[model samples]
Target: MKAKVVALLCFLNLCWLLIGGGVFSALEWQHESAERVSFEDTRSRLLQNYSCLTEEEVTNFIRAIVTATNAGLTLDNSTASDTSNWDFGNSVFFSSTVISTIGYGHISPSTYGGQAFLVPYALIGIPLCGLMLNGIGENIGNFITKKKEQYKKRWSKKVSDRTAEVLVMLILFLLFLVFLVLIPSAIFLALEGWSYHISIYYSFVTLTTIGFGDYVPGQNSAQRVVYRLAILCWFMIGLSWMAVILNQVSTFLTDIGVKAQTAREERKKKKEGDVGEEGEENKAAEDEENWGSTKSAKQSNVELRNMTPIES
Candidate 1:
């Protein structure tokens, strides 16, 4: 039954991912197509303006720019020469995100040695990070459970046990949203000059480890180190909170499946028991009828013998 439940969950998750893919494609395809056409038009205009530049040279130049861009190079003439990605702050951010499984695509290792090291680095670090997150989540869950128990004890008459549990969870969820998600989002909106909605979106994407790379903070080199530390702390707590929520949801689903399976088994056993009892009653009635018929036949035989003796 557990296997079946797990398989069903996997299938549903796959279907959900497929649906997301289709919807995103439908939403973004036209914009992507337009961008491609615009890029091609720009290339043509550039070639027309520069008669000396051959197509091969243009292609090579464009490839070089793209390569640099993907490798986290800043091309701005003002600070480009002074800026370095391998600095202490950026490296700390990179390593933390990598281990936490966020892997925001803002910057990445460009060298062969760095890339090879990344494989083992992440492989070992992800599990260790998971262990930390799990530990934090478990502690949070236990705290919530203890609080729920206390609530239930106090409101034992007014609210049911289930109702108390649900209320506690709801309150915790609201607190998390206000403190962890919405509040931080407001700060991001103010600091990053993004709209409130976009900041909220970024908060969720970062916490969920979906790191789309489209909306990263700290794009400005002038941003302070305090902001970086705050964001890192937020990521740790938010990820742990998310883990707790997911664990509870999974446990709830599994419990539902197990209860349904148990009820079905119980009903089947009851049905078999009823059938067995009915069969036993019918067999007892049949045996009683057979014994009565045999007794009557013996009585008739005795009377016949008495009548024959009188005739003699």
Candidate 2:
């Protein structure tokens, strides 16, 4: 039942990313030439309030974006009237085909409004995509942990240290984080005219819950549904993966603390045994010295003070 609900919510979210963007874009341009919307918008808002966009500010914002994304767009490719050679899936292809790197140079959104869309999609998409992958990662993490436990428990007689196993997982986790999340984000951002370091910074930002939302994906609603779903799934996966990594980290730290405590106890016992010939006072002092000077010293001092009378 829970799974079904999650799926339903995801489906709705994808639809919104598409239909919502389309509506917003249409409203955004309503204040412009009361002429018409692009074919994609026309088909989408056929029966809807395509003119709900009254605010001059929103329409200007849309125009500005179109100009920015296609600053050098010529009359043949940038303008809407040059629809003489438009492709069947011009808008759809522009948005979806980005996944395959076949960025068609024609029918580009030559307005600031359109260029603005790409920035958000990628900014949002990268981490979101990471998240989806991370979800797959978490299930994999549990499966691997369970399998390891099965083998180790089945051979319970063996004194294999869970601590050692945990360390191995940590190293592996870090490696995966670098390879999968960091590397790809770097490549994409660099290609998008971003500095390499900035790309890395962006990667860490999303994973750490520092979602500045400055960078997102799918500004173009050409394939709004696909773009939105891909990003949404990414976020889910990335978040889940982070939780698994944290759990492993916590386990690693705890294992270290436990082992350290056990070692300290063994050392204290050995020192006490070696000083058997000395007085109980000396033996106790030796035990105190064997341990750290913090808790043990304060405790020993208290015991010694009690043993000695408070002189008049």
* Best model number under lDDT: 1
Off-target runs (Cα >4 Å) in candidate 2 are 1-138, 147-167, 182-187, 190-197, 273-312
Q: Roughly what TM-score does model 2 have, to 2 decimal places?
A: 0.38
TM-score of each: 0.89, 0.38
TM-score of model 1 vs. true structure = 0.89
Per-residue alpha-carbon lDDT of model 2 for 10-114, expressed as tens digits?
999999899989998889767564555464475345425655665465558668767754542334445535432224433543453233222334345556987
lDDT of 2 at 293: 67
Pairs with backbone N, CA or C atoms under 3 Å apart (clashes), candidate 1: none
lDDT of 1 by residue, 1-312 (tens): 468768998999999999999999999999999999999999999999999999999999999999888888788998678877778888888898899988888799988998999999999999999998889888999987788788989988998766776677678788788988899988888888999999989988988999887787776637756778888888988999988877766776677678788999999999999999999999999999999999999998888788865575
In terms of TM-score, the best-performing candidate is 1
